[model samples]
Target: MEILIMLAILSTVLGGWGGLNQTQMRKVLAYSSIAHMGWTVIIALINPNLMILSLMIYIMTTLTLFMTLNLSSTTKIKSISNLWNKSTPMTMIIFLTLLSLGGLPPLTGFMPKWLILQELIINNNPTMAIVMALSALLSLFFYMRIIYVSSLTMFPTNNNLKHHWFFTQTKTTNMI
Candidate 1:
């Protein structure tokens, strides 16, 4: 139990501090995942069932993010800065997804974090809950940065590149 607590704290801190200087969008997301995993681990110490739920939610959100990035061909922070110029709808999706991943209210992402925090407090571990909350703020900072770059930046007017028409594929195929 003592070791788990220490690992939880270490991971939370490392996840936040590690992403501070990352220019690659993937790296930022990876660190954010680490931080979120730390939260899951913290709760796992008290209840494994809750941890499973949290991990599943995290996986779903990450899958959505990676798929969006893959479709947009965005790998770095700078590449994503002009996403609004490429596709407004994709940009909006990415923005909302990142915000949800950041644990904003009324999103699926918030549900697990809320449950974990509640569990922590109920389990008589207010100190851990406080620390986790603070670390979460650090993660939110990066998420907001990504959101700003992807949605708030202006498109370059001097570019001569032809805009590609985006079409949604209605055909669903089995991957298996």
Candidate 2:
């Protein structure tokens, strides 16, 4: 149990810290997963059911975030900065998804964390619970950064293209 607790803390630190310098959305997600793993490890120790629930919520939120990036054919954070014009609704989804992944309140992502934190507290591990809560703040920072970049800030775009680079291409196949 001690080893697992140490591992959980390490995972949380590494994932949250590593994501701080990421310029690519995928890398951020990867780091976020690492941090989330730490939470799950601890949650698993206290309540296996909550672990599964957290994992499921994480999976769903991640899939949505990834799909937004994939559908936009973007990787770097800068690439997504101008996505507001391409699709307003997608930008919104990415925004909500990122928040949910960060475990923000009123979002589906917060449910597992809330329950897990409660479980940890009820189990008499207030110290570890506090650590997990602080780590969540770290995760929230990067998630908010992405949201700001993707939605709040706008990069100057060239007027030459009517659509994004990915959507501008036309592939034609001949039927034989």
Candidate 3:
């Protein structure tokens, strides 16, 4: 069980790191969702009774986050550097989703983690609880970086920009 958990966590970390570093926005979110799901699975494995509940909640939250990201036409941090300046509504949604994804309290996203933590404590596994807490913190860092890239700065307008993704989005929207 521990080996499986380690493998799941490793895959999520590598996948998110690779996708985000490559500036592929969708891939980053996709991989991030994978990582989050992994944590949920770890919690569930220890408490089989709560598996369905946690997975269901995670799925719903993942769907909402993906929809928000899709609507913004942003696949990478570089594509939406000036997101707040370009579209305030999208920026707000993105920010809210990131906060939720990070499992901030008072949001729907907090429920699964809260349940997991409670289950862990009930199971009397302090070591696993600590690992889960650290994993949540690590995931938060990446989500915050993505948020920073989108809202906290202007998109660089220059030829040296490595990604040409926004042009396709612009062209499609113009056709509409």
Candidate 4:
């Protein structure tokens, strides 16, 4: 039990701090996955069922994020700054997906983390819960960075590149 708790704490800390210097979008997402998996492992020590549920939610949200990034052809942090010019709706979806991954309320991503935290407290492990929560805040910083770069910044106007006028496809057939 002590080993499991220590590993969980270590995983949480590493996950939060690992992506701070990452410029590649894929590497950032990988670190985020590691941090989320830490949460799942922590809960799994007490209850395997909840861990499975959390894993499933994490998988779904991550799939949505990666698929969106793939479709946008964004592979690096610098490229994400121009995402708003390429597809406004997809940019919005990406923002929401990032928020959800950060475990914000009213989103599917919040459910598993919330439940796991509650379980931790109920199991008389408030210290681990607090550590996990603080680590989550750290992870939120990078998630916000991705969101800000992808949706908040304006495209560079100095370039003479002709903008393509793509008809907005209401149905995201590829997403299915």
Pairs of colliding residues, candidate 2: none
Q: For residue 71, what is the lDDT in candidate 3? A: 77
* Candidate 3 structure quality by residue, lDDT tens digits, 1-176: 87877875665465445544546767667767776767666766787767777777777767876787787787767766666555657677777777777777887777877888777789887666676766676666677777776655775455655443334558779889
The TM-scores of all predictions, comma-separated, are: 0.85, 0.86, 0.72, 0.85
What tens-digit string does per-residue lDDT give for candidate 4 at 1-176?
A: 78878888888789889987788988988889889878988988999999999999999998998999899998987776687676767777788888899888888888988898899999998988899999988888888877766555666554555445455456686465
Which candidate, 2 or 4, has the higher lDDT? 2
Evaluated against the true structure, the overall lDDT of model 3 is 0.69
Model 2 Cα lDDT, one tens digit per residue, 77-158: 8877677778667777888888899989999999898898899899999998898888888999998988776665776667
Q: After superposition, how far is residue 75 of candidate 2 from its true place, in Å?
A: 0.3
Clashing pairs in 4: none
Enumerate residue pairs that collide in model 1: none
Q: Report, for every candidate in turn, its global Cα lDDT versus the true structure.
A: 0.82, 0.85, 0.69, 0.84
Output the lDDT of residue 146, model 4: 73
Worst 10 residues of 2 by lDDT: 167-176
How many clashes in each candidate?
0, 0, 1, 0
Model 3, position 36: C-alpha lDDT score: 74
Off by over 4 Å in 2: 156-176
lDDT winner among the candidates? 2
For residue 158, give model 3's deviation from the true position in Å: 21
Rank the candidate models, highest lDDT first. 2, 4, 1, 3
